[model samples]
Target: MSNETNAILNQVIVLLNRSLAAYLADAVPWMGRAGAEVGESLTAMVKDQQQSADRLAEFVLDNGGDVAAGEFPMSFTALHDLSIEFCLKKLLQTQQEAVQYLQQAVAALERAPLAKALVEETLGSARGHLETLNELLAAVH
Candidate 1:
């Protein structure tokens, strides 16, 4: 992979760890009115993000690239007595952004066949997550 490709992939790792997955995980316990079932689903989404990052990181390492390790997104670190409606809204918004970012990453990774495939898979997952998040948001009262 070229330097540009490596950099983009690393950024994606950071996003998954610090933003997408971290946001959901942090908000799960505070899901006012969303209930245990939504929390469970959010937990699963967090795990999926981690697993996808692992796959990307492994590929990067095998190619002599450093994985981007980072803390949770700044927004996630802030305290808030978040409602289920607000949580779902934020999750859906971020999930939508992640999907767009992944689409760009997939396009950028064309020459890096393995990375492209991995990113494509991630993109697919993100799209699925986006749908679920939308449904969750719609159901919120």
Candidate 2:
């Protein structure tokens, strides 16, 4: 892989990891209480996001790039005590940021076709999750 692609992948991995940490630290604990419809959707999103991150990591390894373990920022843990709606809103913002980040990555990777394709898939997933979160937030309100 090119240096540019590798660098973007690193950012994406970190972002995904942080999102996962936020979910596990804050969202998962309250998913059940979030409401029947929203809870079910959140559960599916959490699982899908995990699979997406794993696929990206495996892609990095298959391309001979080292896959670093992902870790969240320390302050994310401080958000654990917020309301379920607040947690979901925060996750939604994170997902939106990831989608935008991936968009730029895909654009930058145009010359690296394989990397671009992988990033596009992740972007699509992020968009889907973002839409779901919007609906969930509506339900919450």
Candidate 3:
């Protein structure tokens, strides 16, 4: 593979790591709470995001790149454990991070058609999750 290809793969892997970290960080307490279907849904969404990241890693390997290792560290490690209500708000922040990650994937894929197709597939799921979050937010408000 070319240096350019390697760089793009690295960037995509970093973004995938970021997405995984965001979900794991956000979902732990959110999913742990009772009476919070939204939180539960968020957990499921995060799981899907993790699978997407794994698929991307597979693509990276298929293209002759090394799969990135380790989980993303929590950026919100300072926050106290939150209630179901507040966790929804936290999830909104997480969803934003997810959006940014998907956008980065879209940008990275622009230079690699096969990667582009993979990212486009991921993008569809991201968009659906965004819509689900939007509906949840709207209902809560």
Candidate 4:
């Protein structure tokens, strides 16, 4: 894999990790048993995101590059005051954005077939997350 491709994979990994961390931190306190199912679903999604990041990091190492972490500043104040419906909407939007990032990473990694495939798989997972969030959001109203 080329350095460019490695960098793209690393970028995607960092973004995934950052998003996962933010969601975990912000969503947990609000997720009592009433939100237990969704909380469990989010936990599973976090695990998947971590696994994806690990795979991307391994790819970067195998390709002779250091993985650079990506940072996203989280402002939970606005979200803190929101209702469950609003919070779910925000989460759904974030998942959609993650899917878009993974899609772009897949396109950029065309030369690295394995990397591309891994990213595509992660993209599918992100889409599934989006679907779940949509269903949850619909039930809110």
Per-model C-alpha RMSD? 1.7, 2.2, 3.3, 2.2
Clashes of each: 0, 0, 0, 0
Candidate 1 worst ten-residue window by lDDT = 76-85
In angstroms, how far off is 62's CA in candidate 3? 1.5
Which pairs of residues clash in candidate 3, taking residues 3 or more apart in a chain or in different chains?
none
Candidate 4 lDDT score relative to the true structure: 0.76
Order of all candidates by TM-score, from best down to worst?
1, 2, 4, 3
Q: Model 2: what TM-score? A: 0.86
**lDDT, residue 90, candidate 1:** 74
Score residue 13 of candidate 3 by CA lDDT. Answer: 58
Which segments of model 3 are wrong by more than 4 Å? 10-27, 30-36, 70-73
Candidate 2: list runs displaced more than 4 Å: 20-22, 25-33
TM-score of each: 0.90, 0.86, 0.72, 0.85
lDDT of 1 by residue, 1-66 (tens): 678888989888887887644665665536666677677778888888889989999988988888
lDDT of 4 by residue, 1-141 (tens): 787887788778887788733555555546443476666666777887888889878878987889888766566455655456567777887788888888888888878898899889889988988898888777656
lDDT score at residue 41, model 1, on the 0-100 scale = 72
lDDT of 3 by residue, 69-101 (tens): 655556655443555455566556666776676
Tell me which of candidates 2 and 3 scores higher on TM-score. Answer: 2
Candidate 2: count the clashes: 0
